[model samples]
Target: MTDPHLDLAARAGVADERALLSAFADNYRAIFRAKVAGLSEADARRSPVRTGTSIGGLLKHLRWMEQAWFQRVLADEPNLPDRPAGEFFPTNEDTVESLLAEYDAQCEISRRIAAAHELSDTGVHHNLGEVTLRWIYVHVIEETARHAGQADIIREQLDGVTGPEI
Candidate 1:
């Protein structure tokens, strides 16, 4: 099957604003996912850098980001559980496979949520206050792309593998 993420780039020239933003967001998400694939759980949890950011942790954090923005902020789903304090690091209970599955699931949910809303639709954030769906799309794209770059570095440090291919 053709990779949908790869296909996005080909169609970007003609994509509307929402589709363009979604394309960028999905591409970065795919890159982040690719960075974690084929790694052992042990390797994924290993922090090569001094900051202690492992591939597993990044995956988990990205999953939380998806839920936070799409479900909590946008959809305003009630009584969502709180995230762990500070930066998220994976627990022993979090396996690489499980993290990947969770991240993918959350991404799918995010996509559906975005699709249901208009770009002009507004959401009230606790601190940001009254942000548009277009703003959220831009925010997610930047955040995911930044984290994906970090993941690329970590992956390269782990095994010299690079690029966004999966």
Candidate 2:
């Protein structure tokens, strides 16, 4: 059967670091989403490992991570509300569809916000003080890539699926 989540967006030309961020981040995001395609709510909530990171929780966490870097830090919007996450399971409102939709929406906002800043543009981070837009992009790419691998493993635990369709 065709997996809709694996249908990744086409990469734009990587003429600069910004384009590179979009391509790599978007690729992993798509692959990560595909990792949990058609998972039951219970299965999505399962945390087989001691770290207590479930596939559904990873989706929620990734969305939150994107907002933390791109929207709150890079865009310098400190007033954005924070979301509390569970150790492994998502909150009651976090269904598979809702999480995916929110993540995609955040991606759109990230694209728009990222284009407005220069690589050297600076923002105040809560923990790290001042940081550059370049730093945020690099941080996000690494964070997303790590979670993508985690999602791949968790998805395999949920079902027998291994290796991303993307």
For TM-score, the strongest prediction is 1
- Could you tell me the TM-score of candidate 2? 0.85
Give the number of colliding residue pairs in candidate 2.
0
Each model's lDDT comes to 0.85, 0.77
Candidate 2 lDDT (Cα, whole model)?
0.77
lDDT of 1 by residue, 1-166 (tens): 3346855645787888888998888888877777776889888888899999988888889899988898888999899888766436988788988889889999999999999999999888899998888999999988888888888888889989886643
Candidate 1 accuracy as TM-score: 0.93
lDDT per residue for candidate 2 within 1-166, as digits (tens), equals 6444343334445346666666666677777767777888888889888988888888888888888888888887867877674623588877888888988898788878888989889888889999998888788878877888888887787787776743
Collision pairs in model 2: none
Give the Å shift of residue 156 in candidate 1: 0.7
- Worst lDDT 10-window in candidate 1: 1-10
Q: Once model 2 is optimally superposed onto the true structure by TM-score, how far is the C-alpha of residue 161 displaced, in angstroms?
A: 0.9
